[model samples]
Target: MIIHTDRDLSLSGMETFTPKTFNIPELVGIGAKNIEEHLKLYKGYVSNSNLIINKIKEYEKDPVENVYVLGELHRRFSFEFDGMRNHEYYFESLSDGKKEINKDGELYKKIEIEWGSFENWLTQYKAIAMTRGIGWVILYHDKQTGHLLNQWIDEQHLGHLTGLSPVLCLDMWEHAYVYDYPTSEKKKYVEAFFENLNWDKVENNY
Candidate 1:
């Protein structure tokens, strides 16, 4: 595992998350059954995140005696917390309704400034989503540099940029599409995800 970032660390008074509800419409390629199951996994992440924080609090009652336990719990918290957060980004993008990216938006200008054109960025981001593992393809905004960067995160925690925030998140975990596409045809699921995306929601995140 990578060294813990501030987000990966278990804080003394971390608050639990309430799983968010998405107003998702019928989507192309991706079936309703697939979405129903996906949301369940999202909820599991939220509950597990809460459980981990609560467990850390219990272990903290005896910091010296539970040092090892606390250490491991702190490390484990990031996976669950990021899982919850990443899904929120993914699901929200597919929520409300499908719409085209606004060419006039700040996000569009940023994409163009970084990659020369929106299509260039989309092509590269889609290729990144096809990375050979269960992970995420994220578009992050670096506040310090005022730049956008694409990153591939391994297992919900590793590879996140320090001091940056993800404006868009694509879950490439097999579970995200197991009900909609075979492993060999995951590209179709990627296509389906974008087909249903609400770029407005992603812009709001930025």
Candidate 2:
């Protein structure tokens, strides 16, 4: 469920996703065949929990915390992707990966140490499918320091903390869930978001 912003996802590519029956004509170009299709895809993403847990176990080689930072990433991606699909990617107004400093700009060494090798990171990045919501959790590269960091945000606002460019993002918000589950089942919805992650895509993103 944790998704790298990029990676290969032939089955879930932007080309094949269909839109819904009642969606506005303005949204036809947004992908999906229409609005109802979009909504279905959104709910389906929400109900993929086991995939989330298992994927998390697969991604963390170092094990920073038993707590899965990547799963949280997916939760955030769900929120962000839905907002964009709905043309709500911009609300209050705006928004915003890999590397380590002290390497004297050594690309190969940095890739090996900081990311467990470039190939591994690539595999880890592109595994998630569509997500829903309004907020975003992102991964970024601090261009100046050449290090990577993951951060969380509630809206488009930034600068509370400053760092590199965005490597990945996850959206989090209610509109993402209200359509699929009653407010009471928010926990259940969160639990079910692991079925369709595109690991290939995530690896590419990372």
Compared with the true structure, all predictions reach lDDT values of 0.91, 0.41
lDDT of 2 by residue, 54-111 (tens): 4544554445663467658555544434433322221101111112222334443555
Backbone clash total, candidate 1? 0
The segments of candidate 1 whose C-alpha lies over 4 angstroms from its true place after superposition are: 1-11
Tens digits of per-residue lDDT for model 1 on 24-103? 89999889998899999999999999998888878877789999998998889899999999999999999999988999
Q: Against the true structure, whose TM-score is highest? A: 1
